[model samples]
Target: MPVRHPAPTPPFNIIRMSHIELGVTNLDASRKFYTEILGLIETEQVGNSIYLRGLEERNHHSFVLTKVERPHVIRLGFKVASEADLDSMATYFGTKGMATGWVTQHGQGRSLQMRDPFGMPLEFCYEFAQAERMLQQYGAYRGCHPQRIDHFNCFTPNVQASHDFWALELGFRTTEYTVSEDADPQLWAIWMHRKGNIHDMAFTNGAGPRLHHVALWVPTAMHIIHLCDLMSTTGYLDNMERGPGRHGISNAFFLYVRDPDGHRIEIYTSDYLTVDPDLEPIEWQLRDPQRQTLWGAPAPKSWFEEGSLLAGANVQPPVLQAQPIIAS
Candidate 1:
């Protein structure tokens, strides 16, 4: 188990898990999938990149796809409380002996880029150009009608270390966790949040710094079911990888699908709120079947074995290397 420390008052403020920059091999193919099939609104296209956002999102974009030969998670983005928080973040990373740099992003203001202790690429920004929201634009709705960017799930080599840093240093609260049932158990996975939802981010015990999936919040379970039917008829049936099932952990109704670049995306809904400061994290044993899926078959090997590579980082196998039960 990871050692516990009193959660610190962070010097900087983070408002929410904001956006993501996903690198794809073929921008055109990815644009079609994310825009047409996933129902993400295409905001802009510049050179080799495409900018997109969900229907209800007012920000310029929550997702960006850039052309790259290797498909990888380019960077994760967060909304900070103020522009001064950028300097505070840089100082925080510097004190930890980690380097941070400022990068100018189109449609967004000043941003700081750095890698976490586990080397997950991250960015923090405060100002983003607002876009016209299409929430009530009934005629424009298509695919699953993604409402907004939800959360990110990452596979990490050292789950405990990752958990501690985010909880103690960055002030994230754990909403749920799983423990390996070894003689002396260890933290096998954790769901931590800055925003009031169940998770802004989750770290699962696995090989280092890989993206498990980027979840998009859809309106209802019917949206997910609609996606399944649409995919079956539109030659995207094979992209439907997992579920139309519920997770015991978050009680979230979900369906996992693969994009043109093999990056996993989860269409998610039906999770409950977790805003209470004293709310206890739901715990699950590593071998518990229900924790992985409240119903339906176990997740297949591909779901367990495959994930998008992180940009500019090398992979490291987990220290414990404990495997969870998967579909046989």
Candidate 2:
């Protein structure tokens, strides 16, 4: 039997999602789409790389794009409350016999990179170069006007295993979850959070270790409409894939758009607060189609079958195989 590490006594303080690095084929076009179209502020451009932050963000960046031959997700970054948490996490994963390493990227503190029980590239670090907040610069806002990266939704073959590992070892709390109905209720998806909002990261049963979407928080549902108008008038209507609808699980209004490199980005808002540690996680049945989208249009097939492959050490990791839950 595999040994389980008890949740940290002091609980490693995972502040929130700090930033995400993505590999893009065209830096200039991607830069234009993210800055001019999506309305994220570009902090700096270093050769083939560009750094971006949201309107209300004080950090140097919440998202990054680097020119590559193809678009792919590089890493999922998280912020820890203290530097000590990095050491604790390193030791914690080390004791679990996981592959671990330290990476020192420019303008950022040392980051700990590791693959979770299931294979996914994850980085946790404490500090980064801070930037001036553009919250009051209302005139500078354009396009979709996203505020900050709200959360990441990932594809995993086994939601229950990943959810258990994240909740039991990393101290993430489940705010909501889905289970297939019938005689045996099998876990289908879960929304887990470290921050006060609904979720910092979520796992849905699918092909393993793929990123379904990265969500950028908008202030209201109207902003989601604004994105639709922006894309519609700008000749990128096809990029708009799904939503402007509410999710029954998180109660968040959402819109999904495909980036220049086919990476799915979600413009999201309006999830309820999950600050109470003792709060019970809301459960939904998989048979209820409305659970996925409260407004009642079934999710498109691409939403279920497609996702970006995880970037492994040398090549993409082979998808970890598992059976999907059947809703009876």
Candidate 3:
């Protein structure tokens, strides 16, 4: 089948991502892993759930680990331009035959939730409460000192279909793509963005619509090494999936880890900014080792196989398929 593409819109002009809700089998263990090992500060706690953010950020919370009966992703919250946009989006998706749900007076703002055709959970809102920045004088080596939750990558069996839903219905633009050199012209990977910085999200051809990893941005490369060392000392070295390497495309330092539920989370830094109207999308050959890792180490099998499931009241089955080659 031919890959379906979404209609392009002007780049997003608003605040960036706010927080990502992660579902964990054991909320306490997951909270320790993030707060103690990763050095994120706990901002608030409501019953079994805990809200966290980097010490450097003043946002209410950048990461929310919720206590769910199972392991999965609850929803990814993006700060919209205004509450009006949220209502419009809710009606927009409704017109397209997608169901929409609303949450009033929630954590940061009143929000609306929906699912894509492939079953990924998405939420949009404008009611977030801001906090004071807390790391002004931590002096050079704040553990994991991430500024904000940046982007996420997901796997989709029908990459083209998922791309169309995000790009056409939502307002996302393509920043890069991976094309197979062999026959069939299959899309191996696609980097997409909402407003700027090359990509805020990406899609890879894989088993189903699963979240591959959520990328958090740190101020410098040293923070990545510090966090890796911390993970090692805390006896969580086994969680380190890959990393402390430069990416051939983003030119950023990256480290990947598998949380308790096997969901991958990336600690990334130093990628260049993309704010120009004419920024060209980068295309990498599927067979190039440089495409996977700029420093030459191959990504482990687990990193390729594991990801977070989407969450909502009515969860959908994943679009299953055989695994493809590792990007390199």
Candidate order, lDDT descending: 1, 2, 3
Q: Which runs in model 1 stand beyond 4 Å of their true positions?
A: 3-6
Candidate 2 runs further than 4 Å off: 1-11, 313-328
Measured on C-alpha atoms, candidate 1 has an lDDT of 0.90
What are the Cα lDDT values of the candidates? 0.90, 0.82, 0.73
- Per-residue lDDT of 194-226 in model 2, one digit per residue for the tens? 888998999887767788999899988998898
Write the candidate numbers in order of decreasing TM-score: 1, 2, 3
* Model 1 agreement with the true structure over 1-328: per-residue lDDT tens digits: 8634335569998888999999999988898899889899999999888999999999999999999978899999999999999999899879888989999999899999998887889999999999989999988888999999999999889999988888887788888889988999899899988888889999988887899999999989999999999988998999999989999889999999999989999999999888887787878888898989997358899887789998877889898767788998
TM-score of every prediction relative to native: 0.97, 0.92, 0.89
Worst 10 residues of 3 by lDDT: 313-322
Off by over 4 Å in 3: 1-7, 10-15, 137-142, 312-328
Steric clash count of candidate 1: 0
> Which pairs of residues collide in model 1?
none
Q: In model 3, what are the clashing residue pairs, if there are any? A: 108-127, 109-127
RMSD of each: 1.2, 3.6, 3.1
Query: Model 2, residue 92: displacement in angstroms?
Result: 1.7
